[model samples]
Target: MGILNVTPDSFSDGGRYTDVDAAIEHGMDLYRAGADIVDIGGESTRPGAARVDAATEVSRVVPVISGLAAAGVPMSIDTTRAAVASAALAAGASVINDVSGGLADPAMAGVARDAGCPWILMHWRGHSRDMAQLAVYRDVVAEVCTELLARVENATAGGVDPGQIILDPGLGFAKTAEHNWALSRRLDVLVDLGFPVLFGASLKTYLGRLLAGPDGTPRPVDRRADATLATSVLAVAAGAWGVRVHDVAATVDALAVWRATGSPRLAKP
Candidate 1:
C-alpha cells in the first residue's frame, strides 16, 4: 500500500496533493512504482489536528478516486466516516481503511458490510484532537492486541465478514514514541490474531525522533525515508501482510531484496 494524503494539514506531504490532478498523478505514480493499492486520505489524522466536515472530505477524495479508478489504479479510502467511505467506494475505491476502527461512526460497519470490501480496523482510542491524552498503556503489546481483538469482534458483530477484516496497530495516532516502538518490536503478536496486519509507520513522528540529532530536534520528514524503509522491511519480516508507505519504489525494492534472501519465510513466526 502507498500513502496519499489529500488534505492540507496531514503531518507529512500535506498541501502537496490537494489538487485533484496532482493527487491523481501521484496515485498513478505510486501504482507504477509497485504499490498494490494507493491508500488516499482526505482528513489529517496527525495529533492535535482539527476534523474536517464529511462533505469536504468527500469532495476532496471522490474526484481523485474517480480519476484513478478510470486509469485502472486500485485504491483504498482512508476515512472513518461512513458517508465519505461510501462516496469513495461509489467513485471506485475497493477498500476502507478506517483509523478509528469503527468506533467513530455508528454507520461505518454497515457501509463496510454492504460494500463487502476489505476493511482495515486500526487500533484507536479517540479522535486525533484528543488522542494524545489516551496513549496510556500498562503493557503496550498485550493491550494493543486485546484492543484490536475487540475491534475485530465489533466488526464481525456488526455484520461484516471476518475474512474482510484487516488489523492495524494505530502507530502515531495516540501512541508515544515508546508505545510505537513496543508495538513494532512485538508485531508478531498482532499478526498471530489470525487477521492480515497492515503496518503503517511511514514518516511518522516516532521514526523522526529515533533519528533525532544531538540537539534533540527530530529529523525532518523528508529525511526519514530510510527509517521508514527499515520499518517496512522489518514489518514484512515479522509477517505483516502489507505496509503503508510514501516511497513505494524504495519499499518495493527492499522487500524484493528480502525475498531474494529468503528472509521473509524464515523470519515468520
Candidate 2:
C-alpha cells in the first residue's frame, strides 16, 4: 500500500497533494511505482490536529478517488466517517482504511458490511486532537492487542465478514515512541490474531525521534525514508500482511531483494 494524504495538515506529505490534479497524478505514480493499492486520506490525524467536517472530507477525497478510479488505480479510502467512506466507494474506492477502527462512527460497520470490501481496523483510543492525552498504557503491547481484539469483535458482531477484516496497530496515533517501537518489535503477535496485519509506519514521528540529531531535534520527514524502508522490510519479515509507505519505489525495491533471497522465513514457525 502507498500513502497519499489529500489534507493540508497531515504530519507528512500534506499540502503537497491537496490539489485534485496533483493528488490524482501522485496516486497514479504510486501505482506505477509498484504499490498494490494507494491509500488516500483527506483528514489530518496528526497529533493535536483539528478535525475536518464530513462534507469537506468527502469533497476532498471523492474527486481524486473518481479520477484515480477512472485511470484504473486500485484505491483505499482512509477515513473514519461512514459518509466519507461511502462516497469514496461510490467514486471507485475498493477498501476502507479506518483509523478509528469503526469506533468513531456507529454507521461505519454498516458501510463496510454493505460494501463487502476490505475493512482495515486500526487500534485507536481517540481522535487526533485528544489522542496525546490518551496515550497512557501500562503494557503497550498487551493493551493494544486487547483493544484491537475488542475492535475485531465489534466489527464481526456488526455484520462485517471476518475474512474482510484487516488489523493495523495505529503506530503514531495516541502512541509514544516507546509504544510504537514495542508494537513494531512484537508485530507478529498482532499477525497471529488470524487477520491480515497492515503495518503503516511511514514517516511517522516515532521514526523521526528515533533518528534525532545531536541537538535532540527529530529528523526531518523527508530524511526518514531509509528508516521507513527498513521498517517495511522488517515488518514483512516479521509476517506483516502489508506496509503502507510513502516511498513506494524504494520499499518495493527492497522487498524485491528480500523476495529474491528466497523470501527466507524470519518469523517463528
Candidate 3:
C-alpha cells in the first residue's frame, strides 16, 4: 500500500498532491513502483489537524479515484465519511480505509456491508482535536485489543462480513510516542484478535523521534526510508497480515527477502 494524501494539510505529503492531475500521476507512479494498493486521503488526520467537510473531501478524492480506477490502479479511499466512501467506491476504489473506525460516522459500517467491500477500520478514540486527551489507557495493548474486538463484533452484527474487515491499530492517532512504540512491540496481541491486522507506521513523528540525529534534529521524511523499512519488516515479522506504507517497492523487496528465508529473521540459541 502507498499513501496518497490529497489534502493540503496532511502531515508529510501535504499540498504536494493536492492537484488532481498531480495526484493522478502520483497514483500511477505508485502502481509503477509495485504498489498493490494506493490509499488516497482527502482529509488530513495528522495530530491536531482540523477536519475538512465531506463535500470538499469527496471532490478532492473522487475524481482521482475514478481516474486511477479507469487506469487499472486498485485504490483505497482513506476516509471516515460514509458518503465519501460510497462515492469513492462508486468511483472504483475497492476498499474503505476508515481511520475513525466508524466512531465518527455511524453509517460507515452500513455502507461497507451494503457494498460488500473490505473496510479497514482503524482504532480511533476521537478526531484529531480531542484524540490526544483520549489517549490515556490502563494497558495500551490490552485496551486497544479489547476496543478493536468490540468494533469487530459490532460491525459483524451490523451486517459487515467477518472476512471483509481489516483491523488497524491506529498507530499515531490518539497515542503518544510511547504508546505507539508499545503497540508496535505488542502487535502479536492485535494479530490474535481474530482479524487481519493492518500496520500503518509510515514516516510517523514517533519514528522521527526514534531515529533523530545527533544534531538534535529528527530525520526528514525523505531520509526515513531505512527506518520505514525496518518498521515494515518488523510488522511482517510480527505476523501482520499487511502493512500500509508510502514506499511499495522497498516493502515488496523486503518481503521477498523475508519470504526467501522462510520469513524468519534468526534462530535463538
Evaluate candidate 1 by giving its C-alpha RMSD to the native, one decimal: 1.2
Per-residue CA lDDT of candidate 1, range 88-124, in tens?
9999999999999999997999999999999999999
Minimal lDDT window, size 10, model 1:
260-269
Q: Write the per-residue lDDT of candidate 2 for residues 5-27, one digit (tens) a residue.
A: 99999888879999999999999
Once fitted onto the true fold, the runs of candidate 2 whose alpha carbons sit more than 4 angstroms away are: none
TM-score of each: 0.98, 0.98, 0.96
Model 2 C-alpha lDDT versus the unseen true structure: 0.94
Residue 28 accuracy (lDDT) in model 2? 96
lDDT of 3 by residue, 138-199 (tens): 89999998888888888999999999999999998889989999999888888877788899
lDDT of each: 0.94, 0.94, 0.90
For the record, the alpha-carbon RMSD of candidate 3 to the native fold, in angstroms, is 1.8
